[model samples]
Target: MGLDSTPSRYRRIVEEHFTALYGSAFGRLGQVLAVDAAPDGRRAAVLGEIRSAWRDRPDAVLHLVDLDTGATTRLGDGGDVCPQWSPDGTRIAVATGGAARLVDPDTGAGTPAPPVPGVVEYLQWAPDGRQLLLGVHRPAATGGDAAPVVTGTGADEGARGLWIWDTATASVRQLTVTGAVWEASWCGADRIAAIVSDRPTENSWYTATLTLIEVAGGQRIGYRSDRQLALPTGAPDGSAVAFVECWCSDRGVVAGALKLLDPATGTVSDVDTRGVDVTDLRWPNSLWYAGIREPETAVGVVSGTGVDGDPARPAPASTEVAPAAGSRAGEEIWSGTDTIGQFYPAVAPLPGGRFVAVHSSYARPPELAVFDRAAEPRTVLAAGHDGEHRVRDRAGTLSYVDWSAPDGLRIGGFLARPAGTGPHPLVLHVHGGPVLAFRNRWQLGHPLIGLLVAHGYAVLSANPRGSTGRGREYVDRVVGDMGGADAGDLLAGVDAMIERGVTEPGRIGVTGHSYGGFMSCWLVGAHPGRFAAAVAASSVTDWYVQHFASEIGWFDVAFLGATPDTPGGPHFTRSPLSLAHRVRTPTLLFAGADDTGVPPVQSTEFATALAESGTPVEHVRYPNEGHVTRGQRAILDQHARTLDWFARHLPTG
Candidate 1:
């Protein structure tokens, strides 16, 4: 059968196509950072990473994925990510394993940065590129006293400090001895813009504060924001620094806005963030470039320029929807319908003024396309699922369906039901980054949607508020309001599918990871009569306990509107643990042992609660994993378990 005509066999065909393209299904393009052109602009050297990020394997290698020809050259083994070429483009500096490396782009080799034991982080390169800056977690004093990770952060604890390195000399310089410095950028060879925070102790959150430091003269310039901000990117001209600002609200963490701070003047101004929460901040020019959100994704530009001036000024005229004032805008680039809602969208401008956008989806593998304002986008290099081959034999379709919610918000989902099947057992594949949206990029994996469809099962992945791709308001709609609005949206979607004859009500099964896992637990417990069985991985059941154990402590205060010490509000009302008695569905709970973020306690609690309530529940734990399942074996095991659970309960769709 031809690629476009074959719908029933899409899943198996894609698997074969992907295995032929990339050597393994783990060809996950890790991080795309610091893209620049060669001195002559003949070829652009793009620096990126593809590593076992969640797994943290020793073999993780950062590679330079060529934009023009789709050639990938390994940059050697190291913890390298976020590569920045020198002003001369002779060398590329990157955050390698525990340090940094300055490699030659042509040969894919270079000198390594001095290693710093413990916590190592990515900083930025100077405009000259000769110098690199980074943050190294400073160890506690030796002998009598020692501070642990549980203690959190504190002064005198020798928290993560700033460091400067000379690429040419291979010399290192420690800039600070106390507090934590993150999102560091070199303004010039002599100056730097870095965000600093101090804590009374390593384990304290209330004592944290943000500070902007002028590193050239070692000046401590105290600057404050209404909330926490991260990933500060410098403007093209180096006049301002843009960072993400998050605020706590009754609903939960409402991303306030992207703001620009003038390091010289100590002034802060809000950028128009549109309604979508800014996923990334990039500057092709000082005035504007791009901001990315999931679903209906578009690259928008901000044209106006001024200090503390009203960002609400006249909006730019374009087909794109720019962010609102006090927010950031997306790049002035356009991707295809395939990339719109399927995966994370990334863009890098080639040396010749053209741009390359790379995206990956659950329906397809990673692919890169180039575009310019004057010309249409061209697929310069298609993604190789395995080694370096492109999969042209696989084809699929993407559609958005709306399910009504009681909150009056229209919750939508991306459904990739195979074109050939109908009465198939439907697979309710939930998304991971509950804060993220599922896009329409090329996909290859267990082929959740395609595999199920190929295996005679319909697959539906819904966006239950709190999901990105939509504007900020929509994503925040489920903050402290979890289980409140999104849970309703899930049920509505399931019902809608049943009504459309796309899914069998009794044969439906659900599975999700992270926040989706939490939702799965919530669904089985809150509305047990609907789904026959479920698989919840890295989920949270008791919000009260999870809020404290997870690294995202701030999230608890934000999600619940109050901490555990003073509970009993909207958070508890929405907690699935409180509704344990209502659960009737059989469930399989999966957890990662090392996950302090969601904490294994969540799954344990759900299993305990359900079993005690006279419900059948199975708890499976991975020894060394944290938050997610890695390796083809573990992933396959997870899928197998999911399939087994549903097949045992909801058989014969």
Candidate 2:
């Protein structure tokens, strides 16, 4: 065995394989992606189960969960994403493997919808439930399936249009042929609201505009976002349109400012969400929203102050939104730190103010539950009772801690301690996307946090200035600063833990992936001899190389404020590889051979620098993997190597 490898300490990594083989998580239930409520609210269609083999892309199957009895039955055929329940709750439309399929929610029997020219990306049923709107993607020049969009890139890489599929006629017809539509939802049956962009490339999403387009042939501009705009949703009656505007570092993951547009007056009003960034918005009773409210996950109602209340009916002279109690971001119905929604927030709104979602924490495993106004969420489907009970007993203490950074700005993080500890060895777990924040959520179906804690390591997840959850102002602070203040936030957090007698100062280590990986690489070099060991997977070691070769080169311009070709600037000084000469820490690096986002060269460049600096380094590149490590065998090996590496360097027992 390699020096990092230790005796088998934990069970063989089998959760992913178990799910793939038995159709269920081995020690836990399935990870809930999104939930859709039936018409009566007594039943719900839940999307769960992510197999290891399909980790390269997200895949889940639909299931019917009984709210009262807490019983679940999986829908037969697997689905890719965007699961929608028909209005009457009779059928559910799920886009499974690039094809649209309808399954009877009760019987779990499925049938294919009429085929379109392109691959189906999104499925949204009409309000009347007679038809569905499909977001079809067919790259302008690519001749094969949309699957290539995952790895390869070219001009107009993700060009998409809309199609309508009729249930009664069993026929499909084109809806819009005009421009690149990123996201679209029904604005009543005849009209649709969509987020449109001029370019079909990934970076073009940064400057997209929210527009209201008709099914026939008309379009109205709603709002043009300075940052990335997404999730354009319209009211059932087509009275108003709502969408989310945020600075997203990664595609498909969105959460931020909530806005309402009165198409009649062409005026957009900001939705006051009690200061929380809206993640998911649905119009059931009024407007129901789920978002990141810093320390907790909040679900609320947006009511009262209507956006011009049909500003176009009589063409109101003033387009100002009328103010009223609960008119802004609405009222908070339920909130908790442990409740989780995969990407952002996923809730299935019932007929009443209550809703259903998945809940998990350091002590409790994931389970389906119902939430009402100000009441604790009632667990309806507790996963793996025996296994969860054992895990809860072994779970020590999880707390939200904060400390002042070098500049006196208060930085926060979640600290998890194992069974018994006093100054336990610390492992700083950094989250991906310098634009994203680390919140307190259960770590299931993945390595890093959960594995570290079980093996007697205390985890300190720092949410620096760049992370979301904090207001936009806080999020905006990390834009151009990148590795400066954000890095200090983590160092300050480490100091805080040492001062509080929670972790040993000299025994601390660090590990992360993507942006987190970048931090890990930068931290070891910038502060040589600080971290005992470092593991940075799929890391972006050099900004110059990343800006020139990455799929989203614009992301560098947005954060670094300059291109790699720009004489000399942050591109050179901010890169970790430039400082590798001073590094003395033993580091483990990983890269995916097929990762187009960070590219494999990022890790290779840093590995070469480490060897040149005489720093102990081991680099591994996995085939068939992308930016995010998802291959089953790869994840299992990663978990084992990470645990062994940490144990070998920062010894506790």
Candidate 3:
């Protein structure tokens, strides 16, 4: 009845969709991580990974694509290698395995540079192509007073620092004596701009410093502000440097402004971004290009001409220019779509006003596209599968929805409803990051959403108060009140769905991973009667345990304002484990055994509590998996188990 609505049928639907989506000719395109357009504008280099199946580990590869010929060639294996194009477009630099190698774009030939002692964390070719900047990871020696190093979490003891590799002589030299360098860009041949943090911790983003380092003399000129600055790129002439200065209050980045740094004077000036959240800035040519996050996430080009207002003072309101056509100040080259499922769109500028980017919507996989200002965005490489598997029979239509929270704040979300639905069972899917938003991109990580919708279920994915793209104020709402108003915001979204008559009462299930998992646990425990089934993956149960075990334990100080050791702290008061006695819903828990983000102990502790309290619960730990599971088999197993758990506990029809 109603398409069987059984676990076996649900499994079949999931398998069919996963196969149709991954087994198609276009599915081989894989996921594009980074793209760099050559100087000539005739070609581009892409770093992407191909996954043959839903449960297979992705094979990372470097691809050289010809814009004029539309031909693509796969280079050698690129395991987590981020390739960068030389200014002249003759060569590319990438760190493959432990070696930094220079690759010829035309021939796909790689020549090994001098090998650094440790793993390369960051790699970029200098402007002159004579040297490469690298961030290396060297393991600490084992001895008395030497702490054991933790690898995957990026918190290894004195393991990571910056270095420079000379391509001309094949020589390597250490730059920084201590501190972990996250990113570095050459200001010129003799200077480099970089973001350095004390330790590579989970919350290091908040503590990273923007510094201009002299390569020849090893002198450091640091920015004055204490705020987090990122993605430092220098002007071609080395006169100025541009970086995203995250204007964060104790609540996180409330505003991200593109700031210009004078290398000679050590003075910083804010680029009039016209109120847009500038996530990234680059000066590839005479004009400075910025990656915008709010008012629609897209790429915009700004004039590099002199600032009209005072450089040291904040621009008056009158000096600000709105993003409009015919304005030399700034203009969006690519505005995003309002449709659900499109996200993280990027653009790389080539020589002659042409750009290469990965374009896709929620219903479509990413395809490499070329954009010319005069013509429509043309697809250079299309991922073959388009919603062919998502027919009315097995898939639902995705739409954007918004509702007002209890505090009168409007919250946004995406809803995917099954075809021929009438008060169908709904699943509230939460997103992690508490800071991240559920954009319109394809849910590669949560493929089960499609399967669930196909089986007569409705899914509501809400971006509660803490989610990004809503500006700084809304994002800061979750700070120091993690489980308070944000939880209420999620419940408000559920109430809105109920009022819309899209969901049936008493048949709702809840699921999320990481921060979303934490929300799922808190939701089921605080409001047990609202949900029938709950699946929390890599969840944070006790803030106390999270503070002690997580590599990002600093998140406790940032989000909760106190550590677990602080007496009468919010760490225990805000934890979902505190309300474990009230949980009545059948809950499923899954986590990676090696997850230093949330830590496996969080799930284990909660599972023990649930079992002792006689609540129906199950916990599964994926061995060798970290905060995000990259292994194919582990991913498939997680989805299958989650789907089965939901099917057994919640009514699908």
Worst 10 residues of 3 by lDDT: 309-318
RMSD in Å for all candidates:
7.1, 4.8, 6.0
Q: Which TM-score value belongs to model 3?
A: 0.88
Best by TM-score: 2
Q: What does the lDDT read for residue 128 in candidate 2? A: 75
Q: Write down the TM-score of every candidate.
A: 0.81, 0.90, 0.88
**Candidate 3 structure quality by residue, lDDT tens digits, 1-653:** 11233346445655566656665533344666678778677888887767765545777678888877668888766474768888778898877886788888778788987777788866877767777888787755454556564454543354567788887887889885345666778775678887776665435646777877787656464674555677788755566677776534222223355667777776666555554566545556543453434325555666543233112122222232222222234555555652111233345776545667777655666677887667877878766454543432365777888999898998888888887747888999998877766666664235777778876788898888767666556767887788889988889988889999998679899999888999899998888899999999989999988877676666777777676878878898888999898999999999999887788998998999999999999998888898777786676566667778877899674
Query: Model 2: per-residue lDDT, tens digit, 1-653?
Result: 12133235532443422233323453223677778888678887787864533234335777778999988887744655777888777888888878999988767788899888888999798877899999998866545775553344444465688889998899999875566788998876688999887767676767778878988887867787668888888777666678888888887778798887765666677777787778888764366788887788887776542332221122221333333322354667777777567656767777656788877765666778887664678888766445445455544568889999999998888888887648799989888888776666655223356557766888888888878888899888888878888999999999999999888668889988899999999999899878999999989889988987887888888887776777778899889988988888889998999898898998998898889878888888888888987655566667677777787788778
Q: Rank the candidates by lDDT, best first.
A: 2, 3, 1
Candidate 3: clashing pairs of residues: 26-384, 55-632, 341-362, 341-440, 341-441, 342-440, 342-441
Model 2, position 74: C-alpha lDDT score: 75
Candidate 1 residue lDDT tens string, 1-653: 12232233333444353345434534454333334444333344444445442243424455665555667776766455566666566777666666676778788767767766555656566665567777676566554546343344342455667777776687887774345664566543456665565542323332234355555545454356545555466653456666666543211122335666666666666666454455444443333333344454454444443222212232222212222334344334443445521234444544334555654555445555566656866664454543322332232355777778775777777776655647656667677645656656554223444544544556778877777656656756766666666778888888888888887667777888777887887787777687888878888788877766665666666655576776467557667788888898888888988886788877888788888999989998877788767554354455555655666776643
Best by lDDT: 2
For model 1, the local distance difference test gives 0.59
